[model samples]
Target: MKQATAKVSHRLRGAQGGMEGRFRLVLVVVMAGVTLFVLGRGLFEAPDAPDTFVNGTSTSPGGHRALLHLLDEEGFTVTSSVDRLDVLNENDFQDPEAALALLEPSPQFLDKYESEVRGLFSRSWRPPLILVLPKRHYHALQSDEDGTLVLQEGIYSIDDSERVLQLAGLGSELGVRRVTGGDVIEPDSPYATRIHDESDEAQVLEFTSAASPWRKLITDSRNRTLAAVNPLTRVVVLAEPDLISNRFLDQGDSAALARHVFEASQCRHLVVDEALHGMATRASLEYLAVRPPALWALLSVLLLLALFAWREATVLRTQPAEVDARRSREFVIEGVARLMLRAKDFRMAAQHLQQRAPLALLPSRAHVHAAGVAGSTSASLPGEVAERLHQLPENDGSEEHLIRVARRVAEIRREVSLSHHVPSARKPG
Candidate 1:
């Protein structure tokens, strides 16, 4: 009974351990899944709000929404101000009577849209256009019809024969006279007369001091006010950009002024907030238009390689190498001869010759007298004996004549030693 109880306890413990291991595995899997999910969200999600627009430009999320609301209220279809040109071109907005484009002065306005501007003017079916120029540098604004117009101060009127009338002036004076001072009538102005009203809706317009030279247009005499609605081509140019900034859309009566402008304009007006136009995309396209000389570059590299191969094949050759082998043998013989001549030692030369010619019969010192060879004598040996010594054959066993010549060399040494009367050692000692 005790053994049965013990067996049951062991089984229970094993089961418990198995359950705990399974739970840990599940926990690990859940944690891994959570980590991967977080990483994927970070990688694939849109960047934070700050990175949504270019630096130094306002994203104006509220202002953009407010503008859309104003447009809708005025019975006009509203679209995002982002990449306005692409939207216009994609929709084939070349019907002049159908729509007008409202543009603000920003980096995008000054740079990327230059070609689009030219195209718009040149096209017979182009839409009416409006551009906001800074009041301080208003002199820089040029009219394609009449060259350039320079404005120093105060309000100036332009009379272009085209259907669109372009107006550039201080927004503050326009706002003060029209909205705040209850002078809602500009009867002489072509389009302003159509939109003016003395109702509470018209009084809802706000104003602020000019924050910049561009802002001076949005101020009263105190240099503070909302932007003025001066028409360009059924299009209106507002001097101060901050009225449309994300921060100020909800402040004071700015939203009302924005609404009034949209209601007054044509239903299909192309509202181009220059801040949202993508200069990077236009610049990238321009860069792609100018192609690199890749084909020419590749041809040049291939030609260089071919020339290199041709030069190596033609200018260099591998001969039979007889010259190298002959050179090697001559070098060895001359080197050995030089060493023997420099040392002036016949014994050392004989030893070297013996090592080179293994089959040669080498004479012992005792054979010096019998070989008729002089030994360390001041007396000169005959030139014939010296010549005979040099002529001694390099011993190969096939030549009997060489063996006889070796015996003759020994006799010559002996005769020279006797004639010189020099005692010679029996061996080279």
Candidate 2:
């Protein structure tokens, strides 16, 4: 008995072990496939979107497309908000690890959207806001063959930036420092600090508010603020846009600086606000919800659920039951016939029978053409059933009316079926 029990237990254990191993393998394979797909998308995704000055999604020479890609490689999930500032109040953005980047805002943008821009810092519950001040002053040289504005540009001087700052309502405290000769910034430090490759003429911009008492997050040798943050509000101001712009992204420590900005902001999720860049967008979860792998997975789940519901939603009709008013008999009526003659079901059925009557009485090819002519055609319920139908009651659902209609249908069906079998010369009555 002990030997038999042991053998049975051993077999059961082996079966369970095999099942567990198979399940684990399936899980790992699924996870690996997802990881590869996500990485592949990040690696091969489109570089940019259409927009104006300092677009984070635009790959133009003045855009931050490269930096966005770099941020993705560094494990940051970047999205562009073209529609709304729904993120400001969204629960996901409420996390401390989320940041909103307002790319180089020209003076015109600030003039138009200063309230909306300032709202980012004013909100009680918000993500870290990084405001990158404009570096290039744009002047259209000429329109290209594509009607695109070709700009002749030079860096915005400290005094030149005052117009934008004043328009942004950020006060004129910040300045852009231009140093002809400088040193290589140490990699040991954060990206938000000091000007890198200044000897190469790196543009450095600073933002500070005496009222906010923000500590310098990015600065140079003279401690001119390149970026700074308010300890209380968690707002980050990156004065220079060059550090992450497409033109300078690959030059020196800019890529590293971009990564450090993410780390220093304490945010892994970042949104590049493009609504102010003239890209019409609204705040919506659809942009994030449809992100790859998740979309496919959602569709698969929906399909599975649909199949399961189809299989499990079996609705067995109740067996029909009715008895004659005065008889020693119990007759089982069909479910539909037994239903009360209400306006809904029976009225529709009566109309259907009326429409089918002429087809039943006429030869198949007789009812084909318009203007009293005829042609040959055949179809299921919807097509060429009849040129005309027997008139049906508009509202009456009385038992007598139902019986009369039923008897007429039965006669028509009998005549048609018999006519088909009898002879080609025989006509349906």
Candidate 3:
């Protein structure tokens, strides 16, 4: 019964300690899993910069992404690239069947990349280029409602538009002009069937004073050029970007006009130039660790580290180890002695040993002598043991007294062990 009780008590203590250990282990595992998952995602989740850029990947007002999606709806494949035009090959750009569309590109990009772009276009195997002049730019500012950004449209200079068109080798001045009487623009040149305008009154579009060698394909009222093409270079220029931008592409016949413009190019696929608007995509580990989303990734890693540090200092600290389950003989003796001291009844322990001493132990001399007296009992054995024990200085239950008592007990145990192991002598035959 005592052994069962000891086991139960040990088990209860073990259960409590196990629970705490398990909780810490599970917490560490879960936190590690979450940290790994967050790092993996943020490592590659680099978001594009300037949310309102005029690229096919954007959905903002100034972007012409709606036209690209419409082209998809009409069974045309669309892709985009942030790679510079000069370094592009068939792998990055595509074949002659693919058309490269530069929608509302920044004039600064054109001026800076003029030499490289001209070199690209000079390639005989180059894809048809569609250069759309910039219409409006935007400014991103923090809003009053939230810390999030809101894009505000700003006036776009016409000089920037004219600069890009001139770089395209079309010596023209780009400016906005409206029809004097009606919105009906008369198409006077070949390939005029591409016009899909449903508006009776021409909403004004930016036009270019394009002439000879630059065939005006589409025009606003008064025969002002809205779109034209250089036959030799296979480059098409659209002066009016609002006709295809996300904000106005849904207006009457605008979607149809966009489709016709792309379909007439005889290109199988469309590739929008995203490099001009600064959305370069690099998936290298170095780039991912230091790009747009790098801040968020760094913050997450720091938070995880902080949590780990806190756990080490507090929750994960080592607890004082529990005592060994199996008690040693020396340990049991010292433990009982300690209890006796605490109870202030050292006499109780002394009395216990005094009773058991003579009664339980064999006399020291009789230990081997019992073997000699085979069938006979030792009538003087008890008397001898009792005399010996009684002659010792009386135990006062003090620590020193207990020490002497322990030595006597040890001598008694040794004699009893010898008495049991010795061979008995034959009866006095």
Candidate 4:
């Protein structure tokens, strides 16, 4: 008994060992899946740049984003507008203390949308408008490693300075000429802060023309006007946007000078025009959508989520009921027949048939009459059935005899069923 018990325990331990191996395989597969996920995330994440001219982005070393940040720090609400002038109204520029700035807008943008500028001037409540002319042309290049595009910059005068001036409604009155001299500023002016450019003498942006109806604000060492204002239109033009540009902002009190620019506006709110910067446009949206890696990542996430939901639903669904284990009467009959045939027990099979059918078919009519308790003296169909079965020729353990006896029994049953109706069927409705 003890040996048998030990054998059973060993088998149980074997089964447990197989289950443990399977569990380890499952754990290894899960760890491999997680590793792949982390690798994919590292390979596909987007690059983040600290400096970009894009509105609402942080001031970087290469862009004029610092002005926006400075204005925000001074407690003035700064709003960036992406829509065109046609969609904007007086309410957009209606703050009691509001100033508007157009930063390095391209000449092409000004020429194509001249009517929008005119619309702003047409309004009754005229707010101060500042125009910072474009000075550099940067080309965007694709990075080889990540296939991301970065801007490659080149400095030059705008392609069409005259066209831009005309669109701003200030024609040749405010001309632009490249300056070869050092930094030009008016430190004593209230609009000028104590911040001085590095060296107090670096190559800078200086104005070449300062015509009537426009007051000159700053002049270069050569005495050329660098910054001016048109009181009639409330427009301020800064020849060089360097003082506010991201790269020059952190050097030698440039931030202080930037604060002076905002303070000069005397407005409670500042508006930065981003429409000319190539953002919030249908073209940009289309461009991002076409990038292969971003699109692929989005599709992969959706597929994984769908699979997880399907698996969860499958696990939660109820299982089907177990099948019945006991055999039916027909199954028993067929099983017994097969057993008898295999054993070549013809006599026993014949005996089984007689005992199984005759008893159920026979009735108790004769016994009831002997006890004087029957209303009808005729025997039931079962009694007649039993009598007919007894009259058939007996089987002699031969195949022919067995077949004949079985056929006679079937015929008797069929005749009795046809001649006698069931008691329930015979009752009047």
Please tell me which predicted candidate would have the highest lDDT against the true structure: 3
Candidate 4 lDDT by residue in tens digits, 300-408: 7657755664564465533322122124566778998888788886777676676666554443456445555546334465566566667767768877666766786
**Which regions of candidate 4 deviate over 4 angstroms?**
1-62, 89-91, 118-126, 144-150, 187-211, 280-429
Which scores higher on lDDT, 1 or 4? 4
lDDT-based ranking: 3, 4, 2, 1
Arrange candidates by TM-score, descending.
3, 4, 2, 1
What are the per-model numbers of colliding residue pairs?
28, 8, 2, 4
Candidate 1 structure quality by residue, lDDT tens digits, 267-351: 4645444432343233332233222454355446456655654664467444333333545878889988898567665544454
lDDT of the candidates, in the order given: 0.42, 0.60, 0.66, 0.60
**Local accuracy of candidate 3 as per-residue lDDT tens digits, 141-214:** 67768676578887466667666656655544334333333232336433222223454222233434444556
The candidate scoring highest on TM-score is 3
Candidate 3 local lDDT, residue 419:
63
Writing each residue's lDDT as its tens digit, candidate 2 over 39-89 gives 466555542333464687666677888888988888888887765453443
Candidate 1 has an lDDT of 0.42
Which scores higher on lDDT, 2 or 3?
Answer: 3
Q: State the local distance difference test value for candidate 2.
A: 0.60
TM-score of each candidate structure, all chains considered together:
0.30, 0.46, 0.49, 0.48
Give model 3's clash tally. Answer: 2
Look at candidate 1 and tell me the lDDT of residue 69.
57
